[model samples]
Target chain A: MTELYQKQRAMRAMRKAAMQRGVIAVLDVGTTKISCLILRFDGVNLNDEGEGVGSISGHSGFSVIGSATTASRGVGFGEVLSMRESERAIRTALQSAQKLANIRVDHVIACFSGGKPRSYGLAGETTVQNQVVAEQDIARVLSACDVPDYGDGREVLHAQPVNFALDDRSGLADPRGQLGERISTDVHMLTVDEKVIRDLAHCVKRCDLELAGVASSSYASAVSSLVEDEQELGAACIDIGGGSTGVSVFLKKHMIYCDSVRLGGEHITRDVSMGLQVPIASAERIKTINGGLLATGMDDRDMIEVLGETGDWEHDRRLVSRTELIGIMRPRVEEILEEVRSHLDAAGFEHLPSQQIVLTGGSSLIPGLDGLASRILGQQVRLGRPLRIHRLPQAYSGPTCSSIVGLSLFAAHPQDEWWDFEMQSDGYPTRSLKRAVRWFKENW
Target chain B: MSQINPDRYTRSDPAPSLWSYRLLRLMLSPYLRRMVFYGIPALFLVGVGVINITNEQRREQVLTTYSEMKTFVTERPEFTVNLMSLKGASDSVMQDIREVVPIDFPISKFDLDLDQMRQIILGLGPVKDVDVRVRSSGVLQVDVVERLPAFLWRRDDGLEVLDATGIYVRTVTSRLQYSNLPLIAGEGADTQVAQAKQIFVAAKPLKERLRGLVFIGERRWDVVLDKGQRLMLPEEDPVLALERVIAMDQAEDLLTRSVKAVDFRLQNRPTLQLRSGAMEAFREIKLMQLGQIK
Candidate 1:
């Protein structure tokens, strides 16, 4: 509907205004924790120099001056179940970060991994005008693509042209100046539940801050965790969060597919709590201290004390072998991994040239996670940590801060989207569908 | 997929369909979202205002009141430049600068172009740099740095005062005004003021006898004495050569001798051209010494 398009345009305008102001706050509204980062841009334009086409102003430089995190409340499965509690938590994080930065932020770009994200690869093509493609021609081709219904309750979050081909020259990142008879593009579109987005916007409004932009938490995590080579060659970044595990596939520096599994580190902790009848806090401590995927004979002799807060002397002091604790934690972690693998299979991720898997997030911190993921997922797997940021504290340079750091990166240098250009033509649904089907048929 | 709006898809003609599609797509595109959000509401508000303002009497009243408020704020006395002051310049140079960049006072500070005024002031002959600022005391302050005369050069154009960097500052109509400064002359002597200043500093011992310096070929310096003697100095490390010559003069009173010139172009074995009479006497003495040895 035109309403969805209008909302996206409005968000883009807000993002532009915020960027022009040279300072913006990036908020990561995760299930377990909410983080806020304030970035100051140095007003350097990337495209000012002669470089590859993606050198937009976002690729300009920025530095994080303030960052704060708070325990998230009224959030489950990355979705805001209680608006009041989530708003309070977001305010606390933003205020503390603002204090550290010594500047009040009025605009914030938020990222979240909730509302069940769905990815679709849409393709578009147009006959070259004057035997060469202009910016308008590319825009026209993008707008020509069919807007999938994507169900009634879902809304498009990201619609970006991933690849462009001109005549026989395929895999063209940008083809505006090239001479070709026909120009075709493959675009990646991700949609999520509309209600969650509305809730987040409303919450941000209530906090007296403007929602400048929004992104998928999984996509952000992937951008921060995946190495540059892995992204170019093809790789999947599976961000295992506290309440949800995010799976995003990147190829040629573009995310072609993304999905989230409703299970994460919290679920494993819950399983430990239920299996051992220990307190949730104690289970978390035990998980952090003695959690591992592969156990050995030495673990059997190593005992971890699970302190109970029930206030009863009998139940408060109990020691369990590390192997037994690992026994309780492995199945849930395996289940989450199994679900992630199934999503990858459903996405047909094996078709990409590279099958490197990067496992990151707070949950992925479990000792021996990469080994277990590689064994189960059947690909080269590595533990991912957020890339080091300038002046970022050493405490936050871990897998847990991947989403927030990635969100900062996204805010500083956003990938070019479809609406960034002026299209030559307007609205149709069937043209994109036919083009996508043709592309799929030809490629498959 | 179930169609929520099938009527929009029923149009088959490419012309009308494309136009409508383009319009809808443009409106829906996120890039224009803010414009639509604001434009729709603003358009509605403007429409309502236009309908209400259809009465000519009310429109005239609003315009009259707006103009009155604009004039009231712009005419405030505090915003006017009441006084202009110049800083860091001699009174005569300041007066000359004022004549070059004259402005009528009692004007609004906002109406003044500070950068343009600064540029004009810098164009003055003696002004090296200028800074223009408006103080809270309703004064437009101009700070100027006048070029200092480093050396007086006699060029084909006439006598002129040169700054330390060899930039022409002013024409010296009379030499008595700058009698204390060193005098230099050549085709390109103005640009070599720094080197001339160094030579003058090194030749302080013979300052009384020193007349001036002639820059030859824009390279070597010929130190002219008041007694009509010239000391030709080498191009490289002329300071060291001048120091050595000064030391020899202190010990042997070399400048008082009948030597006409000393060539130190070669690092070693300096050659001195003596007066003709002195040269003949030196040759006769050398012949007498040869005859005694025989």
Candidate 2:
């Protein structure tokens, strides 16, 4: 745990250095595509009046100077499968983005949606020694949290203090300088397979980029797609990607739980290829053109020509009714949504005040997905596109590029994680020095 | 009867090779790009020039070419000084000036050292001041101001004409050469030529008898009249003393007497030395009156 804390602290320091350089690249290494967006931080906060996470929803502090996307290779379920091929793919996307921005970017904040994340809600309590809650008391209470044994071979991705409670009062956002006998904190810790992080880091390093920070694609998409009120009132962002459908639940503007199912649009594309006897590329084209969740009587007459490159003319020219294509695609999408519903139910998402579900990512672009997701998830389901950022191109404004856009926002305004705070001093020498300083400060 | 096409399954590579991507990134770096685009080319040109001019012979050749180009611009018809035009000088003085300057015509104006030439020409005796410049149409204009001769000083070596400020204009063999000029002779007489001229002016009535005014003792003047007679005047107001002598000559015919010299070195006292014959005659007449030798 200390080793991971030190490593995360090093990455946070690198992120600060990248922010000082004013140019950082956000990379979304998805299963279907690798998108890179270079953000140039102008250091001008538009709405910096009130302190706790000022409105980065407007994305005013940074601007997207360059954006490029390439088809992903050697990446499955948002995890790098082959270092060489994924390195090449990352190089392609970053090189094009650097060429467009006419500047070289060294630091990258990357996101992936694989690794099977598990969320643990950790609660810790400590008696206030000084009767007034201080930063050290907060740190002490946070350190008092009993970390669960999230099993071996898994690394904590995000450990954030979601809420603070003072004595009998719970849900206190900040308990500093308040009268309380006891202070406690509720921390949300998400862990993932350590091998996935190492592979992604190695891939980015192979592309000659420093991995400044890494985030889960589900959390990143939730940051961009979910509205502020929904995030405050408990909403779930379902990022239906190519190889995975990422589901993240946000409450009080913080993500409490996030998980991803290993089923996405690529599975539906494979299903279409097998059911209709067509190539994967043609099936992908056909799925995008004629894919719908709710089939109508008119969809039966809407025939889509599925093209093939076979030498036989008859085999190249094949037509499939839209109803038949929908028939091939809807079940897999429903399965992905149903998997997301089970994960939300396990997370106790039904107990939240607002069960608003936002469906986003590349696979969410299919027509009638929201209507079907509403039936399965809740009635408050809506198709979500990424929030508009400055200088984002028209082609990347669709629901397909939500994770990349959200990664840009995450790079601009990262949430405070556990490593961001000062650790509680367990050594006696520093504790005595701190006590002396506190005594001197109080007396003089 | 469908045959699968193998090419449909394969995808072309879109990534650049590692070295090429690194090279592109290095080229995109602003510092390296500026160095390759501007710095290296400029440094190369300067280095080539330095190497080409490193040899002594090549350096001399370059200097000669630069001078030749400079001369080509300056030696145009509008810039060439072909002739010299002299003003305010007599023919002899102008000839002397021409010989002293010694400038070859049809030369570039840039090659003309006018200040040195002017200093050389000023060394001539008659030239008091000179102005030399190149005017339009390539004419070198020399304006000479010659000194005017005022007095003739009879030095021991020869007679030389002096300007009014006692500067020697030229020398002559005979006094008749500048007869219209007054003659002053003494060791330091030339420094007081103005006082000598004033004394000569007061003796204008005795011009027929006045030979010249000699500066005696360099402080007083001695007006020399005909028949070897002289009038000694005071140093402070020698002209006024000479005027008193002229008044005495007009009122009492004192100059016509047999006196050899009149001394007015003292202001209130006038003394005269008579000739020897007049002295002997006056003494015998005094003896007859006393009847000592009758």
Go through the candidates in order and give each one's C-alpha lDDT: 0.84, 0.89
Error of 2 at A296 (Å): 1.8
- lDDT string, candidate 1, A1-444, tens digits: 456567777877787677777778999999889999988887656444323586443456788888988888878999999997888778778777776876667789999999999998888878887887887778777876777779988888988889998988899888888899888899899999999999999878876688988999999999999999999999999999998999999999999999999999999999999877886866887899889989999999998876665556566677889999889889999999999999999999899899999999999899988888988997589999998877777767899999989988888778877656554554457788889999999999
Clashes of 1: 11
Strongest candidate by lDDT: 2
Itemize residue pairs with steric clashes in candidate 2: none
Best by DockQ: 2
User: What is each candidate's fraction of native interface contacts (fnat)?
Assistant: 0.00, 0.58
How well is each residue in B164-214 modelled by candidate 2, as lDDT tens digits? 988889899999989999888888988898888788788899999988878
> Which candidate comes out best when scored by TM-score?
2
Cα error, residue B17 of model 1, in Å, equals 53
